[model samples]
Target: MTFAVAMYNLYDKPISNVKVVKTIPDDFSDPVIRETTEGRGEVEDNKIVWTIDKLIPEETVLMKFTCSIMVTDITKRRTGPIEVTYKANSSFAGGLAIDKYDAYTRNKFYVDTVERDEEPGVWDCKLVFENPSEFILQLFNADVYSPEDESEKFVDIDPKDVSLLPAGAQWHSNKWRYESEELPAFRKKLEFRVMPDFQTNVNGTISISDVILEIASITGGMSYDLTQVPTYKEQDVIAKLKIINNGSAPLNEIAINQQYFTSEFNPPNASEVTMIWDGDEVDLPSNSVKFDSNVFRISLKNLRNSDTGLFMPESILEFEYPIHCVNPVKEATFESEITYLANTFPLSQELEFRPEVPIIEALHLRRKFRIGKEVIPIGALGKYQIILTLENIGTAPLQNVVLMDKVPDNFEYGSYSGGKPQITDEVGEDTLKWTIDLLNADDKVEISYEISGTGEYSPSDAQLGL
Candidate 1:
């Protein structure tokens, strides 16, 4: 087969309004290549032109040129999209020649063309050349594989590991067993691009969406009480992570692998407490995550006084996780704090009742008595009546009483008329005692005593001295 090359200007014309101001080099043989314009041009003039080269031999050839144009609205202060397509006839057979066996030659065929439109937004470009001969056709794009950092391809992360993503496109590998016509053979590479404009949109839309590798959080820390720093009940604290959506697209299924440690806990009710989560892997939400301040909680029992739990005050939590950046998985490490909590009670119970006096009272008493003119002679038998009155003078009632008096030598016992009294006590000192069973908080009791004495003497001479 003979090879003949020809150049065609998509943005150019032979006559007036349309013309190809730019062209690819004639010596260039690559079917898929990138060429930039020296300067921008107005649409009316169509100054910029894309040059096409024909590498196949034939009578007539067809070429497809595609690119996205970005249009700026100076008044609106924003950019839009406009896609451009150019097809022209060439004096050759088929299109550009591509070597199927060469990986480098085939990869150079992928290209993404962009443009701005006045009405809509930017137009994304995907150019497909249908008219194919024996030669292969392809597109050219930037290399997805990084030569400097090989570790950027695969990584392992623990549960507590949290990764902050950079602004750009992010991708993670998914095992797809199915086959497709576009890619007849399986390709292992995952491609991602972080465009600045796309990053700006993500930052504006998301609050704190980022990648997170959550292991577990802690509610209690190292604390001491009267006992041997009683270990708190082991509670599974929700591991929280902070992630920033720095990329153009959201990240999903951020796998966090956590190596959980067996915990020792001292419960207030018992001596030991512990718990475990069944799985080693956890999946994060769809959005790019931000910082999470919540704690993952776990129930524990049989806590001990001398032991510690997986999450405790001042406890250190460390783990790793796989990260998605620029479409590949990388390893990231996360470190956090775990805390513990202790309970307490009062030493004494509350009082219900107390003993106390309700009330008190005081009493004062004075009396005077006189003898009337009715005596016959000294030592004469005579009957007389004595009047007496009583009053309440104390807080309590008095009962079971008896009356007694120390009469003079001329006095004798007379029949007294009133309520009878019962004597309760009599002492050798000639004193009498009375007892009363009924008493109130502030009530009083009263009693009286009476006696009579007589002597045969005139008023001037009191009774004979005795």
Candidate 2:
């Protein structure tokens, strides 16, 4: 496939030092470069780089590349993330900030005075200028005269010779010493200028938008007969996947690939599948939405040159369909995963998601009880060992569970494992109950207790309430 990547000078001013670095996808073959508009196109470091001297306003530069594909069952090809950089004549993408005239004059000027111990009563001094702004300073001239006598000149910097001061920098004058009993003072007059803002007559700019590709993720759960599945023997189960575009990049070339494990599930027809994004129903492209015995695919945008996508950035999309239970005779643990391919067209980049699919499963629960009764003297005394085990064998944890077991009277409760369960003695039977507050799916708990009475103890089956 051959696609055109172009850069347009949108501003009214000219731009210079243009550099474009277009990264070719790994899946595509080495690009076959075609003729460019004006700049030179070279392949360097596995990148197609195009650089131009300048671009006039409204001028566009285009480059074309032809890449072949392997044409497998389903393939994804990307063309971006392209990097374009250029400097406009007199502008910045982050907005311009030109300081006021007074701010440029923010500087400091002072004279250093040091007393000489070697020569008593003599003092040395130097004149300095400190620039605190970001512009270069031009020092014109400075004159220092003795305050005691107006005609006595101490320091003189010529006005004809201009001195340059670096930005946020300082300048110092030659040192001079004065012989006087008291601290000597001088009068000074200075002249300098601050560099002014720039002004030019340039016209035109060519700053191409750099491609920012972020892989869109589908984050939502499957909704079906989760808690109310047991209400009907056979019914149509609905599966839904929700997606929200949380990033700034719009979603395009969207397609869904879903897998079903068993043949007992009857996938809905292509026409029956419903897709909605931003409250508008989306129509699947013809001959692209396919349903197989165990898998199905819904293509929102056609695989070739999709003009529009499923949803824009900050939008929501929902894909829902019905799955008929072909056989509801046996216990079913329905599990399936749905993942989506979100891509940006033209300057194509994509993110593949492999997160676990939402599953509706019947968590494993085993409730069992064991009894050991001992009889003494053929019938006089009896002893019993009751053990109840509860195991949660699922990925998620199990909540509350109440275990109830009834034992006949005359059997005194002995030691119990973990802790003794609640005991309530009735007339002819004693209800031995254990309330398990929580049980992690990866753990198991066992309750063992011994009882001795007059006759062989028969314990009823342990029951669970969830």
Top TM-score: which candidate number? 2
Worst 10 residues of 2 by lDDT: 370-379
- Supply the global lDDT for candidate 1: 0.26
Which candidate gets the maximum lDDT versus the true structure?
Answer: 2
lDDT of each: 0.26, 0.65
Candidate 2 lDDT tens digits, 1-466:
5657788888787788788887766666767778799788887756788888888999988887776655442223344567777776555433645666653467788889888978888888899888887777788877788886768777777755546776878878889987888877789877778766554434333344444334343444445645223222455678777776655556566677778656555667877788776787867555767877667887766434453434566777787888765544345666776777776654353555554555554333333332233222222345556667777766455566766666555456667676777766532357777787887766777777666664554433222111
Task: State the weakest 10-residue window (summed lDDT) of model 1.
Answer: 197-206
Write down the RMSD of candidate 2 (Cα, Å): 21.7
Q: Kindly report which residue pairs in candidate 2 clash with one another.
A: 13-203, 13-204, 13-205, 14-203, 14-204
Q: How accurate is candidate 2 locally (lDDT)?
A: 0.65
Residue 137 in model 2: lDDT: 77
- Count clashes in each candidate, considering only residues at least 3 apart in sequence or on different chains: 81, 5
**Global fold similarity of model 1 (TM-score):** 0.18
